[model samples]
Target: MTKAPHRRGADRTEAIMRTTLELGQEIGYARLSMEGVAARAGAGKQTIYRRWSSKGALLLDSLLSLHEPALDYPDTGDVVADLRTQIHAAVDLLAGPPFGPLFTALIGEAQYDPRVAAALNERLIAPQAAKTVERLQAARDRGQLSEAFDLDLAMAILSGPLYFQLLITQEPLTHAYVDRVLDALFTGLGPISRAAGR
Candidate 1:
């Protein structure tokens, strides 16, 4: 059966996005080109342009695609432990081959272009990150976490240092580094009984 044009278009856009992401990982955002993604996806350049107005838009969608199955924060009913899992997951992701350059590109590019920044936060960050905040909020409701815990602040604790090391210093993010950050965060956010190191 012939797929509807919109369905076909959707599939092609997805393919292009995937191809663009792979290309970004290989070529870096500065060198990423629609022609490369189109050739890799077996589509024409016009097809890519028709769907995405610019490279930033395409890259934004590519980042958003990582969340299709959705990266949920592990809710182990213990906020500290769950946050540890989330932090480790993020560290592993940032250090992973696929996301390293892609993330570096998106974040760096977003810093320069307001439109890209807005689109990225809207289409990518909000969708997946909101879930992280909600999980922490749930812990707050269950009395597993303190009411004073800040989601944005907590998120900063989790990913900010990693991004800085990766982006600013251009240092490698390793498992040891991941564990260290989580260790410190858990130190502060640990249960009241353990927060005092009982």
Candidate 2:
């Protein structure tokens, strides 16, 4: 059976995005080109351009498509446990391939390209941060956190060590490390400990 026009377009878009990711991983983003992606994806250049104005835009979309479901915060009524589960999952993702290398490359690109930086923050970073903050807010409403708790600072504390491992030290983002970080952050924090009854 013949596919509908929209279906064909969707298929082509998926193919293009997939090709972009593959090329990005194999060749690195600096070497990746629109023409290369088009040739590999078996689509025309205008097809990619029509969908995304630049390579950074295309890559951001591709990573977001793959990274979205992995980063969702789960509410188990235990805030620390939920954060541990989600943060561990996120650390694992950052340690692996495709998402790992591509996301690292995108971050590097963002250092030089303001457009990519803005798009990354606006699209992936901000939304994910907002979701996390919302989860923390819900926990606070449950009396799991202090009313004056800095959710934003809590977020930074949650992510800081992992980013340091990912970018600076180049050490492994181990499960033990995550646990240690969580333990340290929550240690003797009355409200959080009281809520979990730990």
Candidate 3:
């Protein structure tokens, strides 16, 4: 049976997003164009342009579609352990595969493109950061963190170093490095109970 028009459009959009990721992986975002994605997806350039006004917008949507499931903050009763697990998973995403290099490219694009910057923040960064903050707030509610804990500060502290290393220094986000960051953040600023140590 023929799919309805909207359903077919949705399917085509998915295919185009998938192609964006695959092409971004292969050629990197510097060389990825809507024309290339349309050619690869067997769709018209107008089709892609109709859905996304720019390469960054298309790549942002593609990254979100691939990454949303993998990036959820886990809650396993032990906030520290759960955060460790989630951060490690995040490091894996940032260091490996279709997400990492493409994300790096997207960040680079965002530096100069205000529209992409706004969309990236609203669509991806803000949502994911909110999830991390929610997880920490839950820990506070349960007394795993102090009532005085500055969760907003902690969130910035937790993520800032990682982003710095990833985007600026281009250093490795090793597990040990992540642990040290966690230990310093938890111990010095907001002291999660030593009992909560992994």
All models, RMSD in angstroms = 3.5, 3.7, 3.9
lDDT of each: 0.75, 0.82, 0.85
Tens digits of per-residue lDDT for model 2 on 1-198? 999999988888888888888888888878899899999999999988887877888898887875564678889898889888888877776677647777777777788788889988997778878988998899889887777778898888888888888888888878889999988877633374445656
Per-candidate total of colliding backbone pairs: 0, 0, 0
Clashing pairs in 3: none
Task: Report clash pairs, candidate 2.
Answer: none
lDDT of 1 by residue, 1-198 (tens): 999999987787777888887888787888898888888899988877887777877887787674443357776677666766765666666567667677667778888888888987786567657777787778778876656678778877777778788889988877678778877876676447555545
* Candidate 1 Cα errors over 4 Å, as ranges: 39-44, 66-69, 190-198
What residue pairs clash in candidate 1, if any at all?
none
Winner by lDDT between candidate 2 and candidate 1:
2
Against the true structure, whose TM-score is highest?
Answer: 3
Candidate 1 global TM-score? 0.78
Which of the two candidates, 1 or 2, achieves a greater TM-score against the reference? 2
Q: What tens-digit string does per-residue lDDT give for candidate 3 at 1-198? A: 999999998899999999999888888888999999999999999988988989999998888875674678778998878889988888887766647887777888899889999988897688878989999999888887888778888889999999898899998877888999998887865555668766
TM-scores for every candidate against the unseen true structure: 0.78, 0.83, 0.87
